[model samples]
Target: MAEARSFLQRNRIHRALSRSNLLLGGDRELVLLTALAAAILIFVVLTVYSALLGISIWIGILGALRWMAKADPLMRQVYTRHINYRHHYAPTSSPWRRP
Candidate 1:
């Protein structure tokens, strides 16, 4: 006789398993670094001007990052791979391209 499966027996994958894995609407490392930088500028700099600057920078950049993340969640990975590419690729026919 087959037994009915209970809800507790079912496997539940986390959000990380299915999603593009965003953190604070951008790359995890980038968001954390931005927070640290803003905190330092706002508090460690020890001036009202610096605090204002930090707040503005944080807001502006975070907004941009959110837009970017929405546009392409894998942008950071794509960019890093692109950085090693040569400036020019051979414009040869398929016949010439073969080793």
Candidate 2:
């Protein structure tokens, strides 16, 4: 059509598209790399958890590991070792200090 030809001539549209294509050439490779990394991470996690479940040790470890992962590892260790409900009725003492 005449309109199409005129628009192309005025804008040099084909040349612009080709230039843009050159600039955008690496987009596909980036997308492929991201997908590959995600897949690898997913596979590693699944394999480790499956192994843990098969051995039946994961249940004992899951609670402590999850809590430690959520908070500071040192603080979790301190809290678990020293906190006592039996002492609630007795005089309170600082867990960080010697009795």
Candidate 3:
């Protein structure tokens, strides 16, 4: 029993350390700011949600922000495809004709 518990605890710690490392390896400032915003939003949702409409709007905004962050890679992929297509398919004609 004790051995199993120790293994679980170690696994959790390892996972957390790996996640932290991954975040730190990227844009650390953006990660930290997003984390701060998420924490604040959670606190507000827990303590300040008196009306349904306002709470729903705040939650929607938070969801949209999260979606945008996750969608960045997809956006980059689309942009890359656009550039590749332009390079491969652009017209070869010269604007200045030879005399």
Worst 10 residues of 2 by lDDT: 20-29
Q: lDDT tens digits, residues 30-78, model 2? A: 3345445555655566787645443344333444444544454344446
Q: What TM-score quantifies how close candidate 1 is to the native fold?
A: 0.69
Note the Cα lDDT for every prediction shown. Answer: 0.82, 0.46, 0.52
**Residues 1-99 of candidate 1: C-alpha lDDT, one tens digit per residue:** 999876666688998688886777887777778988999888888898998999899888888888889999888889987776645555566756766
TM-score of the candidate numbered 3? 0.25
Tell me each candidate's TM-score: 0.69, 0.24, 0.25
| Residue pairs with backbone overlap in model 2 | none
Question: What's the lDDT for candidate 3?
Answer: 0.52
Best by TM-score: 1
What digit string (tens of lDDT, one per residue) describes model 3 on residues 5-66? 44343333566544422243333444466566656666677655534545565456556545
For candidate 2, what is the TM-score? 0.24
Stronger candidate by TM-score (2 vs 3):
3
Candidate 2 lDDT score relative to the true structure: 0.46
Q: Which of the predicted structures, 1 or 3, would earn the higher TM-score when compared with the native?
A: 1
Off by over 4 Å in 1: 1-14, 87-99
Best by lDDT: 1
